[model samples]
Structures are given as C-alpha cells and as structure tokens.
Target: MAIIHYFAPMMKMRIFGLVFLGMAAACYNPPRNCNDFKEGEFRFTTVVGENEQTTTFIRRKSIEIDYYQEKADTSSIRWINDCEYVVKKINPKTPAEEKSIHMKILSTTDSSYTFEYGLVGSSKKSRGTAFKVN
Candidate 1:
C-alpha cells in the first residue's frame, strides 16, 4: 500500500506530461503552400569565396531562365510535385553543367521560400532561401 501511494504521484505527473505534449503537437502546423512559389521572379544570394553572388530567375510553367554573372541561362523544369522539381540546363557549356539538379521547397513565407538542392541522384544537399522579386 505504501509503494502504491509513493508511485501514484509519479504516475500522475507522467500522464500530465504526456497529455501536455500531445496537445502541443496537435496545435502546431507548418506552412507549406508551395504552389505560391511555382511561378515567380526571385533572387537568391550566396557567398562564393568571399564574394557575394546573386542569381535572379524567372520561372514559368515548364521552364526557368536564370541571370547570373552577366549571363542568362535557360533550364527546363520537370516538377515532381508542387514542392519538388528537377532542373537541367538547356545549353550546358561544360560536363559539370550537364548534370541535372534536384530541388525541394522546404518551407515558405509570404514572399520567400527556403529550399534544399543537390545534384540529381546524389545524397548531398544544400539549403538556401530565395526572395520573390515580383
């Protein structure tokens, strides 16, 4: 009887903790309206060897045009879904450029999105954020 009395309070605390966690989990929802970003003019900035580089791109239904380093490059887009897509350069100049890149939209805001990108068929991924320009 004494053992039961001592454990009762601990069991009640464990039950309360679980119920609180469940409620918190049920109330949280992540923003993922990916279609809002499917077609837009956006800018992405990254650091390259101490130099800040920016790429501006315009995406349409099945195509994207990127402006970087005073050059415009066009790529064909194959969307796996609303949040995932593959991009292949239309006129790749080198062997490295010939590889396709896989991109996934990880999260979004009112005028920007965070994304993960990597070479197609590769396990490595890098993340970046792009802000809408239009």
Candidate 2:
C-alpha cells in the first residue's frame, strides 16, 4: 500500500515531464538548408478546409504571397528558414478567415517537398500539406 502511494506520484511526474519536453521541441524553429528547397518563383494550388484557392509565391528575403480570386490579394511572410516561415495578412479588409499562417516544409527529396501549414492563432486552427512543382 505504501509502495503504491510512493511510486505512483513519481511515475506520474516523470511522464508529465516527458510530455512537456515533446511539446517544446515541436515549437522550436531554426534555420534550414537553402539548397534543399526549391528557391525560386513558384505557383501552386492550395486547398484549405473546403475552399479551393491558388497561390503564387515569390521568394526573396521573405515570401511575397498573392491570392487568385476576382483580384490578387497580396501578403508578405517572413521566413525563419528555408522550410519554416511566419505569415500574417498584409492588409486585411474584413478580418478574413485566418490572420496568420505557420508554414513548414515536411520532407524534401529532389524536386518536390511535402509541406504542413497551420494558422498562427490557436483559436482558429488549420493543418494541411502540399507538394511543390517546378
């Protein structure tokens, strides 16, 4: 009985500690290898939620974003690295659906990559991945 009381709390604490470390690691973003990603003018298609749209990205120091609809709504995103970036809508007229996008390049081989993206705000969460065509 006493042994159960003693070991249970200690085991629980250790498990909780590991869970925290895993969460912290996921949030860490540094630099990426430049040569690994397609670093030029890119045009691609994106499907977010149920809405289908197209994006044309021009990469310089950051990604210059343009949306194709009736007209082009342009935005700018700063890159943490070649594969990670922080994006916020440039000038939102009516508070669109999402304010910010967290972009991640999942895997890279030769010409294409798998990407995962999410909204910055936790209240509005989104997750999607796409491939690059060059």
Candidate 3:
C-alpha cells in the first residue's frame, strides 16, 4: 500500500505530460502553399562528391525543363495533386533515367519548398529544398 502511494503521483504526472504532448501535436500544422510552386522557375543545389552542383528548372502545367552541368533535360510532369507529382524524362539516355520519380511537397515558406522524392516504385526516399527564382 505504501509503494502504491509513493508511485501514484509519479504515474499521474506521466499521464499529464503525455496528454499535454498529444494536445500540442494535434494543434500543430506546418505551412504548405503547394499551389504557389506549381508553375515557376526554381533552383536546387546539392552536394555531389566533393563539389556543390546546382540545377535550375522551369515548371509549367504539364512539363518541366531542367538545366544542369551545361545540359538541359526535359521531363513530363503528371501532377497527382497540388502537392504531389511524378516526373518522367522525355528522352531518357539510360535505363535509370527512364524510371519516373515521385515527388511530394512536404512544406513551404515564402520562396522555397521542401520536398521528398524517390523512384516511383522504390521505398527509399530523399529530401531536398528548392528556391523559387521567379
């Protein structure tokens, strides 16, 4: 009986803490203005090996053109929704390039959006940020 008395307050405190955390999580929402990024010129930079590489892309309603390493690649954009799309290269040079990429806009700020992308049928995913240029 004494041990139960000693631990009862601790158990109550834990339950209160958990309830507070759950309420906070339920009230939180990240800002996502995915429609604003639907059509625009954007820049994405990533590190490759020991060098920083940048890719610039222009997105229209159904197409996207990417310029990287002095080369331009065109891809068709099939929007699953305002925040999700699949990109397929128009003329893929390799088998890997022929695979379409699934992209999802995770969150956004005034001029940039964070996205997660991966191959259409793959479980692996990667994240990147793209800043709008126009």
Between the candidate structures 1 and 2, which one is better when assessed by lDDT? Answer: 1
List ranges where model 1 is wrong by over 4 Å: 1-7, 15-29
Evaluate model 1: give its TM-score. Answer: 0.86
Q: Clashing residue pairs, candidate 1?
A: none
Ranked candidates (lDDT, high to low): 3, 1, 2
C-alpha TM-scores of all predictions: 0.86, 0.54, 0.86
For residue 8, give model 2's deviation from the true position in Å: 35
- Write candidate 1's Cα lDDT for 14-127 as tens digits: 999999999999988668789999999999999989999999999999999999999999999999999999999999999999999999998899999999999999999999
lDDT of each: 0.96, 0.64, 0.97
Which structure is stronger by TM-score: 2 or 3? 3
Report the number of backbone clashes for model 3: 0
Residue 70's lDDT in candidate 3: 94
On a 0 to 100 scale, what is the lDDT of residue 47 in model 2? 75
Candidate 2 residue pairs in clash (backbone atoms < 3 Å): none
Predicted candidate 3 versus true structure: per-residue lDDT over 1-134, tens digit per residue: 99999999999999999999999999897899999999999999999899999999999999999999999999999999889999999999999999999999999999999999999999999999999999
For model 3 the local lDDT of residue 85 reads 98
